[model samples]
Target: MTVSTDPGEAATAAPPVNGNAPGRGHRGPVWLALTLALGLLLGIGVGLVIPQFLKPGDTSPEAGFLRDMSTHHAQAVEMSMIAHSASTTPEIISLSSDIALTQHAQIGYMQAWLRDWNLSPTSSQEPMAWMPDAEGSIVNGLMPGMATPEQMTALRAMTGKPLDVEFLTLMRQHHLGGIHMAQEILKLSDDKNVTWLAGTMVTAQQGEINLIDMLLKKLQTA
Candidate 1:
């Protein structure tokens, strides 16, 4: 809780759980940093070579979904990093690492596609405008299930079981929103690459949602 932005600042030590410190098996900071770096590099390498055989126009549903979902994934990465650095629960630490690495790499692919299409990653169009009847789903420019700034701030200030519970709860909602967008894209787009990635998000996030639910129940009962 009250996580420091400075890498040089030592984190507040979390108490041991079940006779082992949290992050016992988790990657150290150096390895985590390297793994994230490697993931992005690999993503960019693949994205650059992937044939942009079906280039979606600047305002196409494919572009909008990529742009908006990139933004959505960015927040998830931020939240996950916060939890990963501070949570006492081993399950949460590991889950946070997986989410952060996976989404950050996906962002590399999404941005590379936009670059290949000669499109701006940041759009002039309103978020989710490409989806039919998606009006008013955005609140204060935040899309569905995104944590409010206040909630993120609260999450930073929490510790111990509270941090673990809040992270799981928020992430469960985040995954649901992500799955909804991915599903809508699958219905709306026929571009092979876009559909493939969207399908992946739907499947992976749904599975993660199940794990999050199980973890939340265990935390609550404990």
Candidate 2:
């Protein structure tokens, strides 16, 4: 058995035996102009007119997405932090670091939105309430792509190739679920900032997913 030299290993190592686991677009300046125009219109509607027409309450889709995605991003940051500290491979460590930092920033962005909206970071409703029929394959409450406690424990215990593979697997799934949530929001929301962020997430996460899948195959051969 290969022992892990990961400095963070001890912190993640506890408990055992559980189960497991865990868009692109183009358009030139003309398209960009149209999209931006649409976004401005939506923003104005949300800021000025929409409040009078239909205010988003605590149970609104935006609130639910903010709350749930914050939680979801938290786990990714945690796992990626572990991988960043534990993995022997430089590529894996770098990838994990990028994942951790990017998601960490996103979490902050969402939380700031919550505060700016005068909403609580958490909600009384369930996690996936915003997208009731979105996707059924979720863990714990209803957050998709989250690793169970046991899987996390296992990840903490693993090292080397196993650790890299496991991280890729979990992170890939996590990204997929996040993309799903983002896409769902794009469909349900007309708020310019909200939709723009969601659209950005879909694009970024999909690129990462492709990179992770490629790395997974490369690591499998090593």
Candidate 3:
């Protein structure tokens, strides 16, 4: 499914909610949340000891991917939080919550790995520089599939079906970009742990993209 890169229509004026939808609640699976929490704790614990065996340098692709993807994941969490709070649709609420919690945990793993390598979370090199011939990919310092400030502000002001549609649309684009980076890492990194995480991202985000497409079609047609 193709979406406008800018999502101009999604950024239009819409009725706003006070904070969260009054009667709406997230119906996402409880077990999933617990599993993610457990995984995060385990990841951090393992990260502390892993560096004694092998650690990537500051300019290594593993380091760059971890740092850049952490930043990328942060925006996804932010957008999901906005959608989770305001959207009244059960599917949107559940999906947004899942995305937020999942990516937030993944961020923990990425940052932990960075610390294990004794590398700074922020990088001096350009984003995506680790990827070969990746010039022009970063537009105005924003990574691929990231929303602009104006688009995010417009999303904050929207409510109801409009908000749901926009959130799903934006997230779908975001996932595609994320999946690309993850796939690239899978190809570039020989590190077993890093490639494993990248593989998981590619698989999970692709599945979510399929769901997002279904949700978008349902929302748009309704």
**Each candidate's lDDT (Cα)?**
0.91, 0.84, 0.88
Error of 1 at 167 (Å): 0.4
Model 1 error, position 158 (Å): 1.0
Candidate 1 Cα RMSD after full superposition onto the native fold (Å): 28.0
Of candidate 3, the 10-residue stretch with the lowest lDDT total is 12-21
Clashing pairs in 1: none
lDDT of 2 by residue, 197-216 (tens): 88988998999999998899
Whichever of 1 and 2 has more TM-score, that candidate is: 1
Q: Model 1, range 133-209, lDDT digits (tens) per residue?
A: 89877878889889999999999998999999999999999998899899999999998889999999998899999
Tens-digit per-residue lDDT, 3-58, candidate 3: 55665554443323554344433534576788899999999988976765567888
- Residue 26 in model 3: shift from native, Å? 80
In the predicted model 3, the residue pairs found to clash are none
Measured on C-alpha atoms, candidate 2 has an lDDT of 0.84
By the TM-score metric, which is better: model 2 or model 3? Answer: 3
Judged by lDDT relative to the true structure, which candidate is superior, 1 or 3? Answer: 1
Q: lDDT, candidate 1, residue 208? A: 96
> Distance from true position, residue 50, model 1, in Å?
17
- The whole-model C-alpha lDDT of candidate 1 against the native structure comes to 0.91
